[model samples]
Target: MGELKLMKGNEVIAEAAIRCGCDGYFGYPITPQSEIMEYLALREPWKETGMVFLQAESEVAAINMIYGGASCGKRVMTTSSSPGMSLMMEGLSYIAGAELPCVIVNIVRGGPGLGTIQPSQADYNQATKGGGHGDYQSIVLAPATVQEMYDFVELSFDLAFKYRIPAIILSDGVIGQMMEKVTLGEFKPRWTAEQIEQMSGSWATTGMKGRKMNVTTSLRLQSEDLEKHNNNLQAKYRTIEKEEVRFDEYMTDDAEYILVAYGSSARICHKTVELAREKGLKVGLLRPITVWPYPTKRLQELAQKAKGMMAVEMSAGQMFIDLKLAVNGKTPVEYYGRMGGMVPSPSEVLGALEKQLIGGANNE
Candidate 1:
């Protein structure tokens, strides 16, 4: 173990970035996640690790800065809230089209417009289903605990580099502001120029140097070529779906009812499971760690065994659609949510579970 300390989720992100050898961070200050940039500035990783931490004028500029850094095979990232993330959607699309690897963290807040600063999981569709234009899917990770918030930052970078695509940490305000003990990882040195050439020279823009020039662009004026490129991207996504689906199942083997959730909502569902079990109900919690891959296979298998399922969220049930698709009518999947930054209490969630999943109320 490297070190043990209690840290908030946003601060852990900045610490993890430096320890993971991230090259740069470009982001604007946003509520519930401003600590990410503030901590970076306080730590001064630029002096210690040669990492560049720049506070951009806007989220739009921040994401584009990541695009530039990533194109050169540098490990770059940015952090934002719901509205700020909305501003970066165009840049996110360009990064996807160019197939550059980078990490983006969204500490989501209530949405639709400049909504409340409180936590919300309303950005599920925006993060997973191509928030920007064109056909693209970013690998999305949901971290429920402070420890996971630390772990996933490093994991996101690793996955991004491996796939040459963007990876998103789809966290919420509760997780961002919450504090817990975390076991920090060992420090890894940033990659050198030679290392970049050796590892990413094939596709990265590292100054031509005795080889044919490389162009990184999403633009394909030829229709046939564009189709081919799109097909290739789809193939990669399929492979990722097959290989990278991850979730956590608690007390599911003998579960009569299953609760499906992710991020902070999953934590609440865990308490609901324990409460239900205490009342002689065999309930399980299925928490999706990778929201994009969706863990549909595990859900399908569990659906066959459980009598009913409830999709709990802080939003108006955005992930409910995915749960229904995974169940595919084999079992009743009901939605229980509190929108506009309101989180359902454990008692409220248990009550909904009893009414919706146990009492056999009409699931609509």
Candidate 2:
């Protein structure tokens, strides 16, 4: 039987990593997110699963260690918040450049600088668009609850290993700190010795002999080869967009105004929906679960039926661009949000929606 309990989001992630058969975790402690490391350290996940947990010197070192582990085609992961995630961007760029498999969790905090320990969705651009200097993208998953915190981390690991690309979990303080019920799936062992031998035979860096020489570095000496690598990466991204888009739609069939948001902010939009209905307004919500894929198709489909969309967020308006791009100019995309650890209240979103229709200052 599966075990269900109220758990912290960070602890859920650490436990899920073990249950998912992740081979190793390398990360440094950062505020709000530090609990993730503490949980793993206390649990000693390695003892049960033959996993490895390394508390690296810094976020930079932690991600590089992830890089090293992933090169072996192993299931590896790491976690941090905004500022620390910024430190790992250099390594994130390298992981994407090399098309290696790894999972990263960013328990987002307000940012631009050290920001705050409180939750913020301001890293929308940093996680969606390549934050680091890169011509590559990571598959970004945004989880709004502790349940998704556990589940998305597992799925992100699977996607990372399956696609041989990086997977990122973008979450905020509301979800990270909120206690919620979650079911721990059955524990399973990682890749067997035979499986590892077969994988190592081809892609892994287990020493070059008895077959062809193996190379695991991201650098390309020849310009033509570099171009080929970049082109290949783009092709892979296109494939991912087609295959992995996910979102949730609420009461959108006969709606006149739509609310587009993701992560913890989407929950607040739920309340906004109810209030909008109390006022007899046709309001709905479109919450994107996968941030990188951006659910452009879903928003475009909603555009054909709805009048306009209010793009709500904890950031200024990052997801707004996505809503616009998704709708492809079919409707005006408006925005209302606050940053630096402030959770936009339900009333605030309702006010924005009301202002949009009455004041005519919004999507028109």
Candidate 3:
């Protein structure tokens, strides 16, 4: 077994960044997510692995910093809450339009504005639907547990670099604050400038010594050229949708009712599924690991088998839109959610499932 220790979710994000060979972390402190930077500061990984951590002046500045570092092909990242993320939207658009690879973590809080510091999954639409202007998609991962909070940092970087697209860890305050025993993985050495040049030199702006200079920007003045660029981006997103969809299904083989959710909501729905099964209802869970490049194909398959599906979220039915689209009227799709940082209990979810999908006369 690897090293095991009990740790808060936010702290592990820091540990994972250092261990995964991150070049830098440029972020502003925000509620619930502030510990990510604090933990990094406490560990002082620059002394050990030469990692760099800078608390930026603001979220906008921090996202631009991420764009700058990613432009050079460095594995850099930033973290923020909902409102702070709103400030970074334009920069996120620039990075995506430029097609740079980087990781971003959003420890979601409730809201349209400065909603609350309480945990929420309300950022689902923003994270998956490209909150930034222009047409683009980031590889979005939702972690339901503290272990995933650690594992996805490395995975997000790998996927981001592999596709040269941004990756977002769509976590919430619940996972960020919750403590759990996580098995630490082996460390990867930070990449050298030489290594970065060797790996990403084709498009990365390493010093233009031996080859043609690499120009990175999102500005395409010509309409036709911008259209072509957008088409290319769309093609990349299609490939990702085909190749990188990830999810976990529980008790699905025999299930007649399916509960679809992601992140913290998925954890609650899992218990709801069990509670339902104990009462002789055939319920299952479809927990999405990758919210973007969503597991639509699997959901479509589940729709054929299950009597009905319900999407549960911490948002006001954001992912429910996707769930319904995926099921495509083959079977009924219902929604259960809580907003403004309220979390539903397992019993509440189970009650919703019965009322919405199972107990209804149409479902029966």
Clashes of each: 0, 0, 0
User: Model 3, which residues run further than 4 Å from truth?
Assistant: 361-364
The 0-to-1 C-alpha lDDT of every candidate, in the order given, reads: 0.94, 0.88, 0.93
Q: Model 1, range 327-348, lDDT digits (tens) per residue?
A: 9998989999998999888889
Off by over 4 Å in 2: 357-359
What does candidate 3's lDDT look like per residue over 148-193, in tens digits?
9999999999999999999999999999999999988999998888
TM-score of each: 0.99, 0.97, 0.98
Error of 3 at 73 (Å): 1.0
Cα lDDT for residue 187, model 2?
91
Per residue, candidate 2 scores C-alpha lDDT tens digits across 246-334 of: 89988888888899989899999988999989988899998999999889888888888777888999998888878777888898778
Clashing residue pairs, candidate 2?
none
Evaluate model 1: give its lDDT.
Answer: 0.94
Best-fitting candidate, scored by TM-score: 1
CA displacement after TM-score superposition, residue 226 of candidate 2 (Å)? 1.1
lDDT of 1 at 47: 91
